[model samples]
Target: MKRQGGFTLIELVVVIVILGILAVTAAPRFLNLQDDARNSALDGLKGAIAGASGITYGKAAIDGVESLENQTISAGNETINIDFGYPADLAALEAVVDGLEADWSNAASGAAILFGYDGYNQRCVSYTPATGANVPAVTEVIEGCGTNF
Candidate 1:
C-alpha cells in the first residue's frame, strides 16, 4: 500500500474516458456551428443582394441606362462591375468583390455583392468558414438557398 509517484493505470483510464466523453459530446456541437454560421451568412448575403439590387436598379432607372449587363464603374483606383443577368452572375462582379473581408460568415459565401456606379457602390458581403462550411455547390438545396442572389 505504498503511494505512487505517478498516476495509476486506473486513474489514467478514467481521465481518458472522461476526455473521450467530452469530445464525443462536443464534436457534434462544434460541427453544428458551421451550419449556424452558414445560415447567418446566407441571411446577410440576401440582405446585401437586395440592397445592391435596389441601388443598381435605382441608378439604372434614374440614368436611363438600359441593359446594365457587363457595365464597369471606376471608383478611385478601383473598378466596380455590375451584372444584370437573368439570374445572378457572380463572375462578372468578382473583381470589385476584392473589397470583401474574407471572414464574412453572414451571407454571400465569403463574397460581396455590390450595387451602384462609381460613387454609388454599396456592398452586401457574406462570409464562409475557412474550413469550407460554405463551399459552393450545385445541389438543389444550394440553388434554393440562392434564389435571392
Candidate 2:
C-alpha cells in the first residue's frame, strides 16, 4: 500500500467545520464597528462644537461684538455667524468645526444634525442657543430619532 501525503477527507471536513463555527461566532462582533464609529464621531463633533463656540466667543469679545446680533467673524477663513457672541445656527457651527458631512435639519429652537450609520439614523446632535446669553445647549439624541445603536 502507498502512503498518502495530503490531509484525509475527515481531517479536512473537521477543519472546515471549526472555521465555520469561528466565523459564525466572530462575525457579529466585527459587524457592530460601524455603529461604534458613528458614536465616536458624534462625541468628537460635540467636543468640536463646544470648543468652536468658546473660540468664536473669545474672538467676538476681543473685537467688541458681543452685543451684536447676526455678526459674522472669520475663523480661519470660514465665516461664523455670531449671535450675542455665540454660534447662532448650523451654518456657524459647521463653519467653525469644518468637515462635518452629516445631514442637517432645522429644529424649532436651533438645529439638528443627523449622522447615519449601520443602516440607522440614531446619531443626532442638537444645538439650542439661549436668548440672552452666549451659551448654547447641545443635546445628543440617542433615542426617538431612530433605532438606538
Candidate 3:
C-alpha cells in the first residue's frame, strides 16, 4: 500500500475551521474600519470643496469679481461669499456642501475639525481661501491608522 501525500477530508475541514476562527477573532484587529472611514470622508470633503471653489470662480468671472476680494456669488439658493475667485472662509465652503457640520468642526480660521482622533491632527482637513490667482487649497492630514474617528 502507498501512503498518500494529501490531507483527509476531516483534516481539511479542521484546518478550515481553525482558519475561520482565527479570521473572526483577528480580522477586526487588522482591518481598521474607523480610520478608513474618516480618511474617506475627509477625501470626499476635499473634493467637494475644490469643486465648489471652481464653480464659485466661474460665477465670479461671469460677474466680473474674480480678482476682487470679499465678493458674493450666487450658487443655487445660496449666496456664497468668496475671495479671489474661491471660498472666503469655512462658512463659504460649508454653504455649498451639506452635512459637513455634522461631523466636522472648525479647528481654526482656515482649518476644520478634531475628529476624535488618537493621533495628532491626523483626521482633519485644511481649507485655505484662494488668493492672487490661486485656487483654494484642500488637503488632508494623513499620519496613520488610529483607534477611532
lDDT of each: 0.42, 0.66, 0.68
Q: What is the C-alpha lDDT profile of model 1 across 64-143, one tens digit per residue?
A: 53244545544356544543311124542333234323533223443433222122112223322112213321211132
Per-model TM-score, in order, reads 0.37, 0.63, 0.66
Model 3 misplaced regions, further than 4 Å = 1-30, 109-120, 135-149
Per-residue alpha-carbon lDDT of model 3 for 35-88, expressed as tens digits? 688678777876766677677788889999998888898888888888888778
- Structure candidate 1, residue pairs in collision: 41-106, 41-107, 45-107, 104-127, 105-127, 107-126, 108-126
Superposed on all Cα atoms, the candidates' RMSDs to the truth, in angstroms, are 12.8, 4.5, 5.4
User: Can you tell me which runs of candidate 2 are displaced by over 4 Å?
Assistant: 1-6, 64-80, 99-119, 131-136, 139-149
Task: Please identify which of the two predictions, 1 or 2, would achieve the higher lDDT against the true structure.
Answer: 2
- What is the clash tally of candidate 1? 7
Q: Provide the lDDT at 60 for model 1.
A: 40
- lDDT by residue (22-51, candidate 2, tens digit) is 999999999999778767766776677677
Better of 1 and 3 by TM-score: 3
Best first by TM-score, ranked: 3, 2, 1
